[model samples]
Target chain A: MKQLVRVALLDSDSDVRFGRKMIISSNPKFEIVFESDGLSEDLVAVADGLIDVLVINQRLASGAGVSFYQSLRSLVGIKQATACVLTSAFDQPTLLLAALEEGVSQVVSLEQGPEALMNAIAAAKTGDQALSLGELYSLVLAETPSRELNQDLLRLVGDLPQKLESNLRRLQSVWKKGDAAELENFELKSLTGLVDKLPVKTASELVIRLQRSGLLDGE
Target chain B: MIRWIQRKNWIPEILLATFVFVVFGALDFATQGLLALLCSLVMSASLLFIRRFSFLTSALVLIFSTMQVSFSLLPVFALIGLLLVAFATGSFSQKPWREVNYVASVFGGLAFAADLAFNPTLDLAIFGGTIELTEAGRALTFVIFGLLAISMITLMWIFGQLLISRLLTVGSDIDRLAYEKQQLALSIQLAEQSKRFEIAGEINESVVQRISSVITNAEGGLYAAKASPEAAVRALEKTLSSAKYAHADLRRLFDMINLGEMVSSAPPSLEDLDSLTIAMRETGLDVSVSYFGARFALDQSAELAIYRIIFEALLNAKRHNPKGTKATIEISWLENGFQVLVKDNGVEVERKSALGANGMPLPYDVEDDIDSLLEKVTGPGITAMRERAESFGGSLEVQRAVGVGFTVSATFPVEAIRAAQDTSA
Candidate 1:
């Protein structure tokens, strides 16, 4: 018999938990061994042991969902776990981009219905990632050429700034030079200012840049 | 435009002349010359006097100057009349811009009409010192003046329409900014709550989890048959103490977060006043409260503003009185609106220069803060509170009391509250 897919569900809503559990039970291949309204218990347990997939809600207490993924990735042996964040409100582009940056397997909306969610979970089990149409549009638009935009245009469009842009560039330069002190200082102020103004994807681009340069040690 | 004139800029006068030229370019040469002379003279004279730079005077001066050619003696006579009107308009002028615009419109209208009526027809004929126009010429002159009058009327209409549209745009922009401000405040509230949630999560994991685990272990030990009675009792006591400490910490943490949250959230009311009074009592201040108003829902911002004004009043009392035994807080919702009075009988504090969190004295006096972090955390307390009251078309005031303490009060226009409630519903 094929190994049953182990799933962990994290949400603040009781109804979502019941619905998710019922939907998971209907499928023969997936089994949700852990479900929790609070991320601390179920997420820490999953990080400490074997868990094939993790599902989350958009409106976690704070950086609850993203922080869980960070801790899970840092776990000694469970580095390759697939992750999913299920959200009710799909308006927040920032949360979706954050899930992606944390190496989430997929982000599905709770409003997308049981079939679509089940399909996403099934895909994650096979190492496939899928984003909704809106998420796809946000991601595509996220790649817009920053150089083509001036300050006024940036304010009208993404509101991502150039100094923050240049700080990001300087961050890249410092990381390439292996100046950790300079990179840390420059990144702290620039990233804080930039993160507030820029879309999460653009901000994450810098994170990926730092990781590639070995300044940031994360998978 | 008058403010621009008051600044003594030449660009507007040149523009005004250009406008006149454009409007009356087709009039007979002599008539145009006379009108120009009158316009230039009156503009120069008004620029010298007329109390301040006024669009009304500029237009009036232009009119009177144009009238100089038609009612040569009457033009001088009209000056006194024009001056009287100007003085009357000036008296009504609490809003200078509006008054100036009014003055300008009147003057411009008079100039336009006079230029239309007395347009000189030089080619007709001269009788002694007076020039006579032929019947056709005289009729033609009136026709020309009629056309000019029609043109001037159209010009004034266009000017008025443009002015209204610009004013509307400005008004709309201000409304947009106010809405944006409210949205930004909401976003800040959400973000602050999100941060608190994260902090609470950490505390839950660290303190709550640890205590729960100890209690669970103690229970297991207590139930175990092999364990001695004394050992079990000690374990139970330790668990109980730890649980109590955890509970206290949780309560304190909630209080801190609640205080921060309440700064944004509207206070319950003067009726539920005891919660605030109780909270302040814990902070070591004896608070006395009073109120009198038929309960009605106020604008959320207005209520929050009044709450903050009171909160700040209490803080000021505490800051000034580190040794004071008690303080009095009095609040009343009156027909005029809400009022807050806080007083403490304590040692008079020698006012120190406002220092930031770092203990560095601010370089200059600021009603708010020089430190961005401190400003971000606490500075908005007073300003946002004031803005909140003002947002509901209300006024807020703060002042040092006669004997002791600081008094803060806010008054809302009776109509503003009603209007907001009606629109929101």
Candidate 2:
């Protein structure tokens, strides 16, 4: 017997939910653990153990998918999930950039067939980020750094910008060399052992810059 | 149109001119003969032009009045006519006119005092009595009368200026308040328009997603055709089902956007209720309106919402039945709220047969029962009507029975109905 991947679905429309369920359940290697059109606050209580993958729609009747996922990740025991796939009907650039900053695993268009979605879920279960070629190009083809990135950088370093200028030059070299993933996986724990460094919001920005420079789309 | 209103801004000058003719002209004509009457007439004429060309009026009045005093052309009682123009110069004329009136009044007072000291008969005409005077007494009398004339002229000018300024302050305050009210209303309209565009965006997203679902299932079936025949057949079956469902959803959204004949930007009021019922009756649905308690007021938006709910209910009745559908609209004005109930007998026969064909529906009070969900019927019209009611802090309730037909009721509180009246007050 194959080891079945546990999957759950979140979508408001009943017909969309039914169609997606029919396709996903036909695969023998994936198990349908939980299903709901909505899970207000009772999802934590109902889904006790943990789900391997959570496939959520972007434009839910509840709210935006990224904020919803952030709230869910803060719940006890649910934060340890291996993959979170955001399904969208359209490609919103701001949403893509936010997903990258928020550590979302992948964003797949709702127009994609079962094979593409199943592959995404299968790869995400093995602790890897996934992206389409189109999404990869949108992130890597940066004419200049986004306006939000510049504001975030200015906020990180206070006034007296001369020192900030030098620090940014060294930082750009590190990002271009693409050694951020190695630092997190370093044998001696070079940076994780260092105490009390950057604020949480700035740390999220650094992760986005690293992923953008490294071209870490996995696909 | 705006120019017409601006041209009428000199209404106070016309009124002041009328007062001068009535009081000064009539009194001088009755007491001091034609000469005094002519002098008062010229003073009134100058007052009429004070609002438009005030400096010129002042100059003309001074030059004319100085000639009369120098030539000794009239009686002593008419000499006080310069006071009227002094007040006018201060009230309506430019700054230069006011200075001319001040200097001219002082010189006129000195000349009049000299006349009164030398001419005893003229002094008696003005003061109602005269006194015998020596050489020293003549100087003292001239000094006293000059001071009295100056003080009386100054007081009249100051009074005119103070009264006119107070009137202007009140007028400007009212104008400012009216402008502010118009600005606030415009902003509210802009906010409502943006909300409509947002809804349009959501509708586009929803419609496209529904259509794409059918395509996704069919394409998946095409890829499956090379594998198992059974899997391919099942996928095609799902594809057909999704296509029909998507078509139904699209129709529902279409109905949601176009609720009724309310495409016009002007919102409908309860006054339009009579015409709505007349139109519904013309369509063959037996409709009637009945009211309870005295009719009261409601804000424009709330009235429009009620109008739409009634219109949708009547439409729903006609759509469900073939002909002769009896519907009643009961409007009740309560102490703290308003209520509307629409009851119909359209599907009474079909409902009883439905009980035998599909089994008995659960009672209306068992709201959470699963059987209620299966038997209840609601279309896009009903949902749209409910949303309209809820947006204004009101509510809608629906009921259905096996032997009876459909009923929908909506209620709005007094707070929403009285919002406009309260804000204006």
Candidate 3:
């Protein structure tokens, strides 16, 4: 008989845990050694050398995967563990990209159902570089602002026209949205990310609009 | 010395008195001659009391006093008599020359011109005098002196008025500038308050939607679970998942709302949104995901932006098509940074070009049909998605078909993301 694969799973969802357990229980080639809702200090200790294949959710009940991986890296070093991020939000490529950059061993999306997840795990045991939409999400998540702010900013910008027209509209929109809070929070750090990419006139118009909007009154 | 000089009009007064005394003394010398000596003495005494009179009244007094000087400069002092009349019967502040310097200058100029033009020979036919003058000389002196007098008086009056007008204008301009600054400050304050209201309104809308969705989903699960034990177990499981998200949602809403002294808690990453998708799917939407690219974690704002954009797109798709319609959501990081494409296939239905995201027309008037209701919902939704993208030094694009669907593409500069990470870390 082929050697049964030992798997370690980490995620916040009990349903997902149950579902994966059920899917793997049907297969004799896999066995679950450890399961957790999040990366606890105790789990991180055990995760360093004991686990062969680790599957973590993008989010844990206690903390995020990025922070978890960062902490894990310090404790166990990158060479010790082979980790995978199993996520449901494969619709966001940034999430997958982010995970891939983190050096996770495998990435899978629940959107593809249990069959794909099983295949991902089988591949991971063989040392195949298997990654999914979770990695893309990670990539996007790693680059943009907080997802909420990204959405708001994107909505504001997307309303604008494109190329030169887009930039012109962008300026008009930003100029319109300029308020006191925006100015106070408008850090110089994001200038290149947000304003610099806009047309000079449009960027200026946004600043002017915000200024005119009286958003900076108290400041 | 300056005060005394200011108080006295010695030159014109003394000269007139002396002229009168000399003419009368000459007449008296030819006639009685004794009266001329008395007139000279009286004129000298009056000059000593010159300070007691207003300049204009005093000038008139000197003119009268000098008439007697030719008769006799008497010791009783007609000048003293004129000084008593002025002190008892005149207002010094109301004296014309005391306030009107320009008037004084003009009158002085006129008097000097009259003296220069005076010719005894021209006047000899009317009254015989010792002086003589040719007709041409008399005409020349009169014309030249008259012109000089008029020019000097007109120039002095005009210059004085202009100086006063300029000072008045400067004061008023300063006052106007100060008023304008106050108005500007007030307008700025009003704008800030209005902006706060707008933000609060938007946050309220978001919260309402989130809370509503969560409640509705939870209620549905609870009801379904009550109907069937096994099914209830499944429903309970789903509710548990939604509960976590609902809690997270509430927390986020609180962070942004600023109800009190609250810190902006760190929000979820793009990675955390995987659970969001899973939770929302439990509420009854078929959300699909596909990806291609190297992986990287993004700033929290970027991830949230993309998540909300996709969430909105999904919500819009579901709202538009209820009966067994499939929505395709694609997220890819290509040669650019990242791209999001959400397309749905529903039954043939007509959508307006002017509708807003709420399915109403844009409240404000806009010309382009390219930004019609459906277009903005589809297009500007991505535009908003791009705002967060640009905040991370990324870009976004929204492309839509008439009846087909919409595609939203976003790209970020790798360098920008790295820089943000460096700072945030």
Candidate 4:
């Protein structure tokens, strides 16, 4: 007889936790030792002592899956427990890399259903890394090109701060004068052009921040 | 044709001369005065060149007419010559009122003296009788007539000055209004273009970027699920969560883009800093926030601008810095103003090289000025930050020194914030 793998489920959604609990119960080889809709002080305190595998949502109400996983690594008994991250379509490559760097052994997408969850637990029990094929392919495609591009971007924008300082000062003076017309007329094309040269991911992040701030597009 | 008419002084002057000649010559002919008609024709003809040599023409016409015409007919010649002198003085005089008054006074005095010396019983129409007066009475009468003539000339000169000044003022006002209208049109066009660019940038940053992220994560999950049965559940879970987030993000994007709904109900303020810090930390960034000095309220726009400046700085630090890099945000409220400083302890990436170590050429040259280069690479984020700060009469600074972490600081005058509070109250 095979040893049942002790499993702990952590998610912010009660329905998701209930559904996952039902799916894990079908597999006799997996034993649900602990489950919670959220990560609490109590859960973190007891999770290492009782569970062989920690299945957590990548996004928790309390914090990120990557950060939570990093915190778990410092806990007593969970140091050796397999940490599996569950992500959604909203996760970016940057997030995936962050989770992977934090020593998360398995990345599972909920869209893959019950079988995928079972497989991740099995792989975790054996101390083997389990990755979705899509993630592997994306990593392969994104890693090399992005690194090279990022390096190039880092070098290209090296003197950006010095260049923008004077204009910033001028803008400050104009603002102090309360001249809305001049502020509206002030040109930002050169700045936009420089940012366009950066890698897509980095540029997109900055651009999104600008959009949120009502900077990129006029309010 | 209109410009030519405006520029040529001779055309109007010649036309006036012709009208005067026809009127005066016809009158002389009807009276059977041949010499008088010839004198009228010659005087009118000379008036055409009055603008060219106004003083010379006036003196010559007066002297010649005084000698050739009878004393009674001399008044008619003197009238024609005075008309020419007034017209020339009006056109040529820089100080028209002064010049016309001086010339008119002299002409009136000379006419009185000439009548008194040449014709004793000068049928003084104004006095109503040809009184053979004593020498004292004749001198007094000459003085009375000269004074009346000077008073009449002064009145006409004053009226002419008022009319000319009024016309000039109207013409200048019309020109100014036209220039203002043109400037208004240009500014409107520029504002429209700016609005379009802003919309495009927003879509690119929020909608497009979020969709792309969704697609990438979906593909990653699908491939992972298909590769190994053991990894299927984990991959599927991620795909589901990502899909859900994508749906929510898309709905938000649509609301903003299609319905023009505002994403934030109220503009974020300093009180919202804790949430912003938490959000960054959720992205696996090590974010810390500290406040120093007294906390005070700011107006909506100023608060929003300050919030955005700090938000962008923190986001930039989180995106560029390595995982676990510590980002610290400090808010210092001084006596007269407030300052926000965001600092990150991350890798000090060199930002000046245009070429790679292997001699690979870059899109931009190494020699490009820092301003243009930074503008190109950082895009509108920094520019927008500076603009927001400036919009509220504040200042923002970014520092990136070799071997040192990146720092962004923004300072705002407290008066603006306080003024906002006063208005709200």
Q: Can you list the residue pairs that collide in candidate 1?
A: B55-B104, B56-B103, B56-B104, B59-B107, B59-B108, B60-B107, B63-B111
Model 3 spans > 4 angstroms off:
A13-28, A43-45, A48-50, A86-91, A109-114, A131-219, B1-425
Predicted structure with the largest lDDT when compared to the true one? 2
Docking class of 3: incorrect
Q: How do all the candidates rank in terms of DockQ, highest first?
A: 2, 1, 3, 4
DockQ score of the complex predicted as candidate 1: 0.03
Q: Show the lowest summed lDDT stretch of 10 residues, model 3 chain A.
A: A199-208
- Docking category for candidate 1? incorrect
Better of 2 and 3 by TM-score: 2
Report the lDDT of model 2 for residue A187: 26
Please, what are the lDDT tens digits per residue for candidate 3 over residues A1-219?
777777777766665555555555445677888888874664554465656567776667767765666566566655454555455434455554445445554566655655676777786666554432222223333454232223433454455445634444443444345444443343333332334343211222233223323321212
Interface Cα RMSD of candidate 4: 9.9
Better of 2 and 4 by DockQ: 2
* Cα-based TM-score, every candidate: 0.33, 0.42, 0.28, 0.30
> Which has the higher DockQ value, candidate number 1 or candidate number 4?
1
Q: What are the per-residue Cα lDDT tens digits for candidate 1 across B1-425? A: 43455466455445544444344332322343555445444534443334445554556555555555444322222233333334323432235643564445355445544443455633222223555556677566666654554455445434544654555555565556556535534644554466457667777654643354344335434443143565456555656666676787788677656655622233343444575666566556677776566545665544545555565666666665655435666655566555556556442322223465778643333432233224322345557556656767777665544223345566676556542554322
> For model 4, how does the per-residue alpha-carbon lDDT over B1-425 read when each residue is reduced to its tens digit?
43453478789668767777788777765653676677666666656655465554555455544633343543443344444445444443454334733464356445744566346545546446554777777677667766765565555545545655555545665555546434433433344344434554665444433443344334444544444555546545654665566577667556535532112234456787786676567656778999998677677657766776887787688777767677889999888888999988664322223356767533333444353336323546787778768866788888753343677888988887554435322
Task: List the candidate numbers ranked by TM-score, top first.
Answer: 2, 1, 4, 3
A212: Cα error in model 4, Å: 32
lDDT of 2 at B121: 43
